[model samples]
Target chain A: MATKTLIEAIREAMDEELENDPRVFITGEDVGPRGGVFRATMGLIEKHGPERVVDSPLAELSIIAIGIGAAMADLRPICEIQFADFIHPAMNQIMNEAAKMYYRSNGTWTVPMTIRAPYGGGISGGLYHSQSLEALFAHCPGLKIVIPSTPYDAKGLLKSAIRDPNPVLFFEAKKGYRAIKGEVPDGDYTVPIGPVNVRRAGDDVTIYAYGMMAHYAVEAANMVAEQDGIAAEVVDVRTILPVDREGILESFKKTGKALIIYEDNLTMGYGAEVAAILSDEGFEYMDGPIRRLAGPDVPSVPYSHPVQEAFMPSPKKIADAIREIAEY
Target chain B: MADQSVDLQANAASEQARPSDSLSPEILLEMYWYMLLSRRLDERAWILHRQGRIPFHISGMGHEACQVAAAFAINRGVDYVHPYYRDLAMCLAVGMSAEEFMLGLFGKAEDPSSGGRQMPSHFSHRKLNILSMSSPVATQVPQAAGLAFGIKYRIAQQLQDPEDETQPRLALTSLGEGSTSQGEWHEGMNWAGVHKLPFICLVENNIYAISVPMHQQMAVPNVADRAAGYGVEGIVVDGNDILASYDAMVRARDRAYSGEGPTLVEAKTYRPVPHSSDDDDRSYRSRDEVEEWKRKDPIARFQQYLLDRGILDQNKIDEYEARAKQMVNQSQSYADEAPYPEIAPSLDPSSVYAPVDK
Candidate 1:
């Protein structure tokens, strides 16, 4: 195992997949010699030749739509949409073709393609560059949604997505790319698409988070454990679409209280879906109503530090939600 | 280079396969049959939809000849196809089972294309290598290029010997006229052209897009002319003429397979029906324009051409129509009997996202 940043882990996964499978390839703007804007595909083109590491035209729909076509021809293509903010141009392809290929064709043509986008805001990426659009893809039925918090999970989950016979929207949190680091294995490893993992086991209040919010949840859980004398069980849902309802329900049962934390807007955010699912499915096991700590319902992610802090779900807010739920 | 010339010769031979000589006598009859069948299926689906039997219906009425001819000439199973929603004839000609089409129309559990997940008109089949059609138009164009590139890659894998047979080529994808307005279409065509990728861009131009006509949608005279900007051959084919469509597609496929890059075929046709059962074309289009296109009816022209060539007698043409009518009836019956997907099935997301065993 080697200690690596989230970006490095993603690069390692791409390198490994390129080496392991001739059919596997990476295509997007600056993916070739430039090695990607975030360098997630660094040194891949040199190692695997230009054919495997294609530099696609600067068009989002072409980048994504072509990836779907490539998958239909049986090439496992992983596409990078420079930034999640720019994905609006290619939203039709992702929401329609890539997502629905399998179910649309009744399993005839499965597009084993992965679309990796740098998502979420924390470092003030402005309005266009930072947005947690997981809910957009999560709303689509056939598409598998994945958002990893750590480097290890990023690498493994990316590998699984590359090989999986279904279309996957692999959202890599930009803030977590270097902010989070862990020892990732050198050899081939795959993290299963679905299931919530226990981040820090506790019994008091269950905090469900994913992507960058997972880190904030951990900090909140730790702070609550020390200051509030409340144990917050944090569950990082790696795969957002096929959410591990059982694991989340089990956590909710153990804690008897639940809090969903996300960086996306509170209104119609993925948190709403989770909150609804828990309330509807595990209402009997709940002590109080499931509380949600989400980014305020706003059009743009704020640039001002104070305004941004208010827009995003902070550890303090999450901890307060945990405390409120625990006391209730 | 020699292989290209030889393929061109074979194309010439296929064009002159029988004594009648014209494409109408050779392949136009079959093309017409598929078009009528597809149209009939669309009609039946619209009726079922009105009766509250099916939820939705998108008709591919007037663009049949171009779609069917392209589908007929392509090597099924070997060649890949990325078809847009308006390619029902293409799907049928490529061997999409009537049962699958109807199941898809009815949004049934047994629908091989969408398993009741997608609405009607979104067709896909595995055996034919046809990528599933999506509701979002123009998105499939780029995907078709990628699929064609993959076919080349796969063919490369099979060519163990340096002096072995030339790489097997795959036909690219088809799209609508309005889709040309999307940037992906230009991007995809340009990329495929620059790379000399084996792909054909068949633009199924059925005049209007909902209420918007070609004049309002594009500045250029024809979408095909835009291909020259990307260094690919562009041809303006009479989409309504089955023989012309067949000739155009056959050439496009040959040019693509022979490493001559891509071809942009603008099939100029008309949409007889509305965009969907929900649309009212009379509100947007003129009666005079509709009448003009009706005079150029693809099925009638091809059928008449065949009769004039003595390749198809009146009895044979009637027989084919009767057979197509019977097939449509059978498909509608099958669709009626088909069951809707159980709402409870969605509770288990495993069916949708099951892991592929490595």
Candidate 2:
């Protein structure tokens, strides 16, 4: 095993897949020469050649549409959307075309394609770059959404997503690309798409989070344990759509209190769905109402660092919510 | 004054350009048969829609000649097609049976396209390499380009063996004139042109997008004129003339296979009927205009060509029409008696999103 950043892990996963399968190729703006905007694909073009690592035009709709078309022709395409904020322009292709290809064709055809996008706040990317739109994508059926919190999970889940029979939306947490580093296995490995990982096991309360918020949830859980003598369990909900329902329920059954955290807005974010899931299935095991620590309902992510920090769910905010639920 | 005279002369030249007789008698006869069959099926579908037997109906009306001609020119079962809604003739020519069309029209379980999931005219048959279409207009343009890219890449890598054919496989995508206004169309065309991919873009210029007229929708007089900006060959054909459209498609396909890049073929046609059963042509168009277009009906024009060439007698025409009508009748009855599929337990929302073991 070797220590690596989340971005390095992603690059390694694509590199391995490209070398393993001839049908696998990467395509997006600047994915060929410049090695992507964040350098996630730095050295892929030289290693795999320009045919596999394509540099597409500045058109998101065509980028994803071409990927769907190529996938239909039996090629495994890994499409990068540059940023999660730019994915909206290609929503029709992703939600309507790619997602519905298998179901609409009655399983006669499938789009085994993966779309990766950097998402979340904390780097002050402002409105255009810092946005968590997982809720909009998770609402779509026939599409799996994967959000990894660490380098290990990032590489494993991305590899599995590229190999999945169905289309997958792999959202890489921009905040954790370099900041969150861990030991990733040297050889091939894949984390299953729809399973939860317990970052910190405890009994007093269950803190559900994923992506960038998973790190904060663990920090909050640790803080609550040392300061307030409360044992908080942090459950990283890896895959958003086909959520780890059993894992969440099992964790809730032991803790009897749930605190959901996310960087997206609270109105209809993924946390709301988690809250609903708990209320519907784990009500009998709950000791009090499910508490949520999430970004407020704002029009857009602010540009200023202080405003952006305030807009996201920090560890202090999560710990306070956890403490309130633990005491209740 | 000189430019006006030149324009008038060009119009006169186009009017004098008749359907080419280069195609063999057998091919011309088959084109006539498919055109007649498409018209008969469309007429029956509209009747069924009016009788409340079907929920919706979209007519291909005056575009049958172009559709059948283009389909005939392409390599079926090898090349890919991303056809639009008004491609009944194209689908039929590409090996979709009349029974399949009827099943789709009735939204029956036996429908090959979507099995009662999508509306009729959204053609998709895996065996024929026909791509599935969505309701969103012009969304298939970029997809066709991508498919062409895949075909080119595979052929280069020797992943797909060319089946005894000299020319490489290409992708054919069709759309209406109004759909050209969509940004996806431009993006797709630009990409194909830049890559010089084996792709063909066919625009069935019927002069209307639902209720919007062509003049109000586009700044150019002809949709093919836009191809110059993309650095691809553009040609205009008489959509009412099967031979003309067939010849144009043959040239376009050859150019694509020869590594000359993509081509845009604009077939100037008209929509004789309303866009759909729910639309009323009288609101946006004049009855006289529709009646005038009926005089140049593609099926009638092709019949005249056959008669003039002495390839088909009046009795033969009657027999062919009867055969087409009988086929449509049998298919409609079969689809009407077909049962709907039983709802599967897995279709439930609770089970659909349930976590599965890895």
Candidate 3:
């Protein structure tokens, strides 16, 4: 196993898929010879040529529409929106077209495409560049939403998402592109797209999260365990939609205390669903009230470093929340 | 034709209907047959709506000539069609059975389009390469560009890729003149023009987009005038003339398969009927205007043209009417008997995105 960064893991998964299946191709604003603004698709155009790695116009609506049509025509398309915040223009294509194609067509037609967009705030990428859009898509039933925390999970889960029969919205935490590193097995292996990854095992309180927030939750769990001996469980909810209900309940059952975290705003954020699920199904097992720690509903992460830092949940915030849940 | 043709578009209106060298009598009759079938279906739907059997009905009564002609001129199975709701004639020409249309109208389990999911006239036939439709206007326009792009891509990657190999493919996407105002429509057309994908767009301008007239939709007198902006050639055709519409689409298809890029064919016509069963056109337009357009009906003009060419007599015309009526009657019976989909009373996991729940 070799240690790779999160973005490197994503590129590796795409490289393998494009090599394995010629039907697979990538298209976005700068995903071609330019190698994408984030460089997540770097070296891919050199390996796969221009046709397999297409450069689309700046129109986000058409980008997703092309994916839908190509997918319908028996091609596996990985359409990247340059940034997470830029997906709004393509929302109709995503929500009405890609998301509902299968169900609307009554399973006769399926959109086997993946939409990749780098999301979240930590890199001083103010309003437009740093926003989380998972909650908005989580409400859509036909779409599979996957956001991985670690390099290993990013590689495996992305591969799984690409191969999934339905359309999957793969949101990469831009903050962890190079910062997060983990040992990823060489060659062929896929982490399935329906379960939670238990990063740390504990017996006191459970912390559930996804994307970059999940990475911070594990760190907070370790911090609480070392200093306060809070014994907190940390579960990375890699797949957001059709969430790992059984896995979530199992993790909550161990600790009997739940604290959900996310980088998106708190109002109806994805974590609220987890808290609701815990309250609904894990009620009898709960030893304390479920807690949610998320960004304040301020539209977006501001440009100022302190404000952006304040917007996102850090290790200290998660540790404090975990400690409070354990005490409760 | 227009007195002075625009720079970006070629005018396709013929002053009189001539016996076309391009179409044989058999092909013309086939086109007429489909047109009549679609009209009969549309009329029957209105009747059903009036009878309280169905909730909604949208008629393509006056748009049939261009619809059938454009469909007949194209390579049906090889080309893809992203049709708007008022494309009944086009769907029939592409091999969708009449009963299937009825099944869709009734939203029965046997409906091939959406299996009781979508409303009537939302045409879709998988085997014929007709893509499924959504209610949103102009959304399929971009999808059409994508289909053309996919075809171009697969052919370019023929050796390495395993997509079907008929090198040339044309994606024919059509919408009412109203849909051109949508942002997605521009996005779709721009993509087609930029890539020079094998694509053709048909904008059936029926004068009025429901209650709103053509003048309110855009500032330009013609939708074809917008073609230069997208770097594609546009054509204005007399949609009521079957021969002219056929010629426009045929020429557009030739340009696409030859790698000349996309062509926008704006077919000028009129919608005699109300927008749908839900609306009243009388509130907006006068009865005199409706009656005036009915005189220029495509079916009647085409029938008269065929008679002038000695293609058929009154006896043959009666027979065609009998055939269309019989098909529609049988389809209505079949759809009425078709079963409702077997969805559970509550939320069915299988219908939604639980395919990966395991």
Which candidate has the highest lDDT of all?
A: 3
User: TM-score of the B chain in model 1?
Assistant: 0.88
lDDT of 1 by residue, B95-121 (tens): 887777898887788876778877776
lDDT of 2 at B258: 81
Residue-level lDDT for A89 in candidate 2: 87
* Share of the reference A-B contacts seen in candidate 3: 0.57
lDDT measured at residue A152 in model 1 versus the true structure, 0 to 100: 86
Error of 3 at A3 (Å): 1.1
**CAPRI accuracy category, model 2:** medium
Task: Point out where model 3 deviates above 4 Å.
Answer: B1-20, B159-168, B354-358
Tell me the lDDT of model 2 at B233: 81
The numbered model that scores best in TM-score is 3
Listed in order, each prediction's TM-score against the native is: 0.87, 0.95, 0.96
After the best TM-score superposition of candidate 2, give how far the Cα of residue A136 lies from its true spot, in angstroms: 1.0
User: Ten residues in a row with the worst lDDT in model 1 chain A?
Assistant: A99-108
Q: Mind giving the per-residue lDDT tens digits that candidate 2 earns over B69-127? A: 99988886568999999999999988888999999999888888877778998888887
Write one digit per residue (lDDT tens) for candidate 1, span A47-120.
88888888988888788877887787778999999998888888878876676666556556777899999998
Question: What is the lDDT for B30 in model 3?
Answer: 88
Q: Is the docking of candidate 1 incorrect, acceptable, medium or high quality?
A: medium
